[model samples]
Target: MEKIKLLLTQYQEAILYIVFGGLTMLVNIIAFWLAFQAWHMNSSVSYLFAWFWSIFFAYLTNRTWVFHSTAHDLKTVINEIFQFLVARIATAVIGFVIFYFGVNLLKQDAQIWNIIQNIFVIISNFALSKLVIFKKKA
Candidate 1:
């Protein structure tokens, strides 16, 4: 138990971020699929929906779990969202272009490439969320 606890704490923050990211990505993927396939939305519309989904979930999970900022409420969350978007607009634009090209244009069947692109977005998302959205304890 003690050893387990030690190991858990050692990787807790990283593990939480990873899990949260995966879940958030799941939200984005589902939204994308629904918008594109089910609702018959255009690629651009589907992409926009997915983008906003990712952004919202990224802010939410990162703030509540990764950063553990219990002090902030809805107003703070909104302000942080604006800041996060502003700082990440460039990174996310790049990420979206890469992801969209790979998934929609290239039609990448290789899971590796898709995963790699998603990792880039996740890393970029984490940086933005940490520095701008829900800053970690100082």
Candidate 2:
């Protein structure tokens, strides 16, 4: 129990991030599924809708819980948000390219491709947040 507690203490942020990441993925997947399957939207359009909503959800959770950002001032908060959005946009572009190749060009399953893309996005986002966006102030 002590060892388990130590482990949790050491990696609490990561564990929390993973939990929230799963929720973010759920949001993304559900939005995509609803847009594409239920509403019969174009795949690209559906992906955009999912991306927008997921980014919003991810930003809220990541800023508040995952990274515990303390930027309370208007300028700092704006800067933090801008940086986060930039990183997310970069990942989104990568995801879009991967999805295009996997689903449109190679004729793979959208669901499967989306899952794979999200795995990459989650890892990249974590690294970006930890290293760049929400790094601890020295």
RMSD, one per candidate, in order:
4.2, 3.5
User: Which parts of model 2 are misplaced by more than 4 Å?
Assistant: 38-40, 94-120
Clashing pairs in 1: none
- Considering summed lDDT, which 10 consecutive residues are worst modelled in model 2? 116-125
Report the number of the highest-lDDT candidate: 2
lDDT of 1 by residue, 96-116 (tens): 678778777888865666677
Per-model CA lDDT versus the true structure: 0.77, 0.91
lDDT digits (tens) for residues 1-138 of candidate 2: 999999998998899899998898899999999999999999999999998898889888999998899889999888988998999889978988998899999999999999889888878989999999889999
Task: Name the 10 consecutive residues with the lowest summed lDDT in model 1.
Answer: 129-138
| Residue 119 shift from truth in candidate 1, angstroms | 3.7
